[model samples]
Target: MDRIEQFAPPAGTAGTTTDVGGVIERMRGFRSHWPPGDGVAVFNEVYLTVTETLGRHLSDGAFRDREAVSTLDVRFAERYLAAVDTAVSGGLPPECWRPLFQYRLHPGVRPLQFALAGINAHIGHDLALAVVDTCRTLGCAPVDLEEEFERVGDLLVMLEEQIREDLMPGPDLLQVADPLTHLAGAWSLERARDASWSAARMLWRLRGAPPLAEEFRSRMDAGAGLVGRFLLTPCR
Candidate 1:
C-alpha cells in the first residue's frame, strides 16, 4: 500500500469538510468512543487539551497575525481530523501513524510514550503539510508564515513538557537503568521541532516541482513513521 494509505479518511467523510470546529468535534466524538486510559484516548485527550488552549490563545489576541495563525491552525488540525475519520471508518492511517494505532494498547507502553509517539507523528509529518496548506490558503510564501509557525511550535514545545510531567511514570519507573527512562530520553521534542521547521522550508522550496515535492513529502512521512515505530517499541 501507499505510504499515505494509512491515513485515508472513511469513505463517507473523506475530505467532506474543511471546518475546524468540525475537526475538533470529530476528535471529541472519537474520544468518547474509547475509554479514557486507552492509548488512542490518552493521546487524543492531550491533543484536544492543546488544541483548546490554542483556540483560547487565538481568541485573546495572542498571535501577531490572527488570520494567518487561524488558517495555519485549522489546516494543521484538518490533517489529523482526516486521519481519525479515516481510521474510525476503517481506513488505514498514514505511515507515520501506523505504529501508534497498531500498538495503542500494548501492555508494555506507558501513557507518556503514547503521547510522545503521537506528537512525533503529528509534529514530524502533519506540521509540515500544515505549513504548505497554510501558505496555499494565504497566497504567500513559507517565509510569510514563519513567525506564526514558530509561535505554534513554541506552544507545542511547552505543552510537551507539561504532558511529560503529567504523564510521567512513577518514581520507581524513573530509575536510571529503566528501559522506559531510556526510551523517553531517546527522543527529543526540541530536536523534532527543529527538524520539522527545516522540513517545512524544504517542502516549500519544492512546491513548484510536483515530482520532487511528492518524493520529499513521502520521505518525510516515512521517516517520521519510522521514528514513531521506535518510540512505541515495547519496553517492559
Candidate 2:
C-alpha cells in the first residue's frame, strides 16, 4: 500500500470526477510555506486566523492571539465539515485517512471513525498540548482511542447544512461536490468565493513567517526528529 492508501477512495471525488492526476498535482502543488515548509505554514495560517477571530474570548485579553483558537477556527471547522461526509463515508480511504489511522491504532483504524470537525479541531494548541503532555508521561506519543467525540454532534449538524441545506463546501478542503454532488446553481458561485480565500491563505502561509506566535515558530522549527515523530503520533 502507498503512504496515502490508508484513506479510502474519497466517496464522491473518486473516478473521473476528482482526476487522480489533478489531486496529485494539487497535493504536490501545495506551496503554502517555504524556508521552513508548507505543512507548518498551512497549519499556522489556520491557527492564526482562528485565533484572531476569537478576540476577547482568548486569555491574551486581545484579539488575534495566535496561540488561542478563534472564530476562524470555526471557518476551518466548516471546511472540514463540508468535506467530511465524503471523507468518512467510505469505511476509510486506503491512503491518507486509513493508513494514518491504522498506523496509530494498529490492528485497526479507529481514528478514521472520527467526524470531520473532530479532526479539524484536533490540531490546535489545546489538543496538541494534551498529546504532548500524554506523550511526556508515556515516554512516547501514546496511540490510543482517537479523541473527537465531543465535536461529532456539532460537526454533523454543519455537514448537514453544507450538504442538505446550504449545499456547499466550506472553502478550505477541496470541494468534491462539483458537477458531481452539485451541478449548476448558487453553489458554483459560492465555491468560487471559498476557493479564492482558501487559495490565498495557502499562498500566504507558504511564503514566509505566518500569523502564528513566536513560540509556534520555535516549535515547528524545533527539529525534524520531533516533527516526524509527531507525524506518526497516535490519535487516541
**Which model scores highest in lDDT?**
1
**Residue runs of model 2 more than 4 Å from their true location after superposition:** 1-61, 64-71, 82-84, 91-98, 107-230, 233-236
Model 1, 1-236: lDDT tens digits are: 55334333333443534555655666676665666666777888888888888888988999999899888878887877767665655778788888888887789888888998899999899988888888888899889988888888889889888998899877965878877788788888888878888888899999889899999989999998999888888878
Error of 2 at 99 (Å): 3.5
The TM-scores, one per candidate, come to: 0.90, 0.22
Ten-residue segment with the worst summed lDDT in candidate 2? 108-117
Q: lDDT for each of the candidates?
A: 0.81, 0.30
* Number of clashing pairs per prediction, in order: 7, 23
Per-residue lDDT over 153-183 for candidate 2, one digit per residue giving the tens place of the 0 to 100 score: 2333343344333322345532555332222
Instruction: Give the clashing pairs for model 1.
Output: 6-92, 6-93, 6-94, 7-93, 7-94, 9-86, 10-86
lDDT of 2: 0.30
